[model samples]
Target: MKNMVYGAILALQFLTRFPLPVNCSMDHNTLKWALRFYPFAGLAIGGTLYLIYNLLNGLLPLYMLTLILLTLWVFLSGGLHLDGVMDVADAVGSNGSTEKKIEILKDSRVGSFAVLSVIFLLLWKSVLLYAVLDSSENELFIIAIPMMARFQALLQLFVFHPFQNKGMAHYWKQHLSMRDVIIAACWVLPFAITQVTLIILFSLQICFSFIFGKWAVRQFQGVNGDTVGASIEGAELWNLAVLYSLFLFGIV
Candidate 1:
């Protein structure tokens, strides 16, 4: 029980900017269970966003509300995934060899690609959120988005080989057992089973992770922490886009 509580704290500490009462321990054994609590952290993030949406809904213009929500979303994660997206953009844009690309990812300097990527990603998410907010039925689905995103990240950790021998990705790959994966899924399964639509969406997220894992492996020879973060951000956007598409077609 204590380990589980510490693991939850560790996950929240690593994944979000949320304040918690418990001190996070970095001991490898304790940290290994952090992945098990990742979905719980996502649930917390999603619930917070849901509350914010309800509180602010009707009080502001849709565009403005989306802008504020986007800001808050970024603030919550401390732009950790955005940094990953930027690093990935720089790597892909370099058009270098695999070794060179890895080097580019490791470099701290931002490039033109990184700047452009951030602009495009923020713009894309803001626009998508605005569109989703325009539909009343879609509001409730927001809580699932972050949860699915984190699930995709966890799936990647299980399926892909790590790019580096050190760092967070490698550490998680080393410590995350199949049981940890099952525990993470257990956190998400109830919500996913609530609706057939959600089941389909959940399946799509798994498929996305599979495809993404393959592509990441091919591109970098293996996935890294940056790619994992990038995958989470990408999954959230993809989830919104797909849900919006379904809404447009009157399928959901």
Candidate 2:
């Protein structure tokens, strides 16, 4: 029970800018439990977004509101995943050897590819959010997708080998278990139950995560923090796009 409480704190502390009631240690046991709470962190993010939308929906124009939401969306994570997107972009865009790519991933400097990738990422997110927000579709998806995106990150454990036996994954992999995954999966059930129509959305994310997971395996040769973070950002954008598409096709 204590571990679960600490794990939830870790998830919120590490994943968001939200202020917390207390601090927690990041010991081995607590860190392992952290993966199970990743979904909870996501749920908090989505819920905040929904709350903000309600507060500002009428006061702000759709474009401004969408930009604000997008800004907060990135800001909430302290741009952690965007940093990953940039790292992965620079690494892959270099079109160099695996050794060279891994080297780029480690470099703290940003590159042209990183700049361009973020531009496109934000642009696409803006467009998609505009569409979704404008539609009469349930805004709950704004909440669900972020949680699902984090859930997708947790999928990294099951998806590929570690690029090396090092970093946070080393500690986390030690504690990775079916129970953690099951707990995380349960975090997703509430959204599905809330809207039967979202069943399709949930199924699509599972499929997309695997397909993207396979691509990451081939690209990086294994999972690393950059690839995993990139996956989270990708899943978030993909989820929004999926939501918009569903709205477009009258599926939702």
Candidate 3:
């Protein structure tokens, strides 16, 4: 249990900008465990956001809490995955063959399509958040959004092959054992009970992301870190979009 908590903190430190002191031994094994525990680390992030939401509640308006949480949420990752989503959008939007699109994605410089895509995604997400902020479903949002994003990230383990023989997958692809799967399942089960419909919707979105990611991976000949990050970001956005629409329909 101590190891798992340590693993969780290690995952949180790697995934977020939080200033937690966790110095694990620099080893391939440690990296793999961290990746496996990544979803659990998300529990910490969601819990923190919830605390902040409640804390800011009398001091500021709901919109302000929304803005603060939204900004911090992306920044927590240092906007790493968001950048990947932008690059992917640029590559896909630009008229090109598979090879060309992959090349565009690999380029370090940000293209016009990338800029527009990021702006649109962020705006869409914020608007969706605002629309659902006052709904009866808002509490569910606090739990689901972060959990869904983590689930999206975890899905990459099953959906796409790592592009390179090196990088994070060099560690994760090996350590994702049956135990890891059980752990992830345990993590999401309670949330599933809280809102079964939303969980189903969220699962469907994740499955869609997996399919899209598989296609993208095939086009690019397996998935790189960028593509994996893009998958998570896309999943997060799609989940929120579905939830917001459901909130309008008075669906729990």
Q: What's the residue-level lDDT of 110 in candidate 3?
A: 91
lDDT, model 3: 0.71
User: Each prediction's TM-score against the native?
Assistant: 0.96, 0.95, 0.87
* Off by more than 4 A, model 1: none
What is candidate 1's local distance difference test score? 0.87
Candidate whose lDDT is highest: 1
Among all windows of 10 consecutive residues in model 2, the one with the lowest summed lDDT is: 167-176
The alpha-carbon deviation from the true structure for residue 41 of candidate 2, after best TM-score superposition, in angstroms, is 0.5
Q: Write the per-residue lDDT of candidate 1 for residues 144-224, one digit (tens) a residue.
A: 888889988998998898987998899888878888889899888888888767787788999999988898888899999
RMSD of each: 1.3, 1.5, 2.4
RMSD of 3: 2.4
Task: At residue 229, give the lDDT of candidate 3.
Answer: 75
For model 3, residues 184-249, the per-residue Cα lDDT tens digits are 756666776576666676677667667867777766767766777777667767777777777677
TM-score of 1: 0.96
Give the clash count for each candidate. 0, 1, 0
